[model samples]
Target: MKNLIILLLFLFVGQQNIYAQKTIKIWVVRHAEKDVSNPKDKDPDLSPLGKERAEALAKYLKGEKIDSIFSTNYKRTRLTGYPTADKTGLTIQTYDPATHSELAKNLIKNAEGKRMLIIGHSNTVQEILVAFGAQKPVKELTEDDYDYIFELTIKGDKREVKVDRYGAEHHTKE
Candidate 1:
């Protein structure tokens, strides 16, 4: 019931911004689950469920008209966004994970009034969200967390965020 309300709110807002020239809409998501086969591997690809989650992400944003897609330079993050890029005919651009503030500034300045999708890591998403003007406290993403879609709408200095879910419901691994 909570997700349904959030989804409805997101859809309503999404509709309102489709043709607006002064609003910027950004959907920030953590990369889907990665392969844990090689636990020591610094970089890894998406696991089978991750791939399915990727597809679900794409399908969820099918008509959102994303103007750009951004991802960290890791296989897991790249693949998490690949399905959406492929479906939308947009290429995934890489950003330096360490420069979260810079990336937020660049996007606000250059990509104004456009919709974007950012696929980031658990540790990076919160920082990026803050840089884009999220004033309230946001929880850190845990290893077991992977289903949040941080919907952001920016107009000049004002930014509104809505946390919604996409793909299958993820339960925290206790």
Candidate 2:
């Protein structure tokens, strides 16, 4: 009876560990710099510096197990996420910027236990982070800020968020 009880306890503990191991990590960042030369163009592409920053982002996350990539339909967001998508051989999925909450819910539900990347705009990054139940209050990114990376880790019912910077330092003119 003692041995049987010990085995049962071990099985229960192992199952808990397996459940605890199921974690989902999301990497979110604002889109790289945009080319503002064409004022009439509503959707401008990334500038040269943005391209280099995108490459740097790809190199930084090269070894991460990114299973999925999400970007808005706009050119700048897609371009920012393109390098990483290309490197990981995963097609970039477009999400509607208008329905950020729904997108966040769907991603958390459907892509649970996976690592994903989301490329968004300066205004939307903080909104998405809030949707993920992030504890820290992340202010809206500035127009010229392109180096912030928000990492959201969801382990079961618990969530952890961290803000980190990547790529070269971008100096804005006063």
What clash count goes with each model?
A: 0, 0
C-alpha lDDT values of all predictions: 0.89, 0.87
lDDT of 2 by residue, 101-123 (tens): 89888877877789999999888
Candidate 1 ranges beyond 4 A from true positions: 1-21, 172-174
Model 2: pairs clashing at backbone N, Cα or C within 3 Å: none
lDDT of 1: 0.89
Off by over 4 Å in 2: 18-21, 172-174
Single out the weakest 10-residue window by summed lDDT for candidate 2: 132-141
**Candidate 1's residue-wise lDDT over 1-174, tens digit each?**
999999999999999888565889999999998999998999998999999999999999999999999999999999999999999999999999999789999988898779999999888887888988875336567887798888989987788989878889888434
| TM-score for each model | 0.84, 0.91
- lDDT at position 58, candidate 2: 96
Candidate 2 local accuracy as lDDT? Answer: 0.87
Prediction 1 TM-score vs. true: 0.84
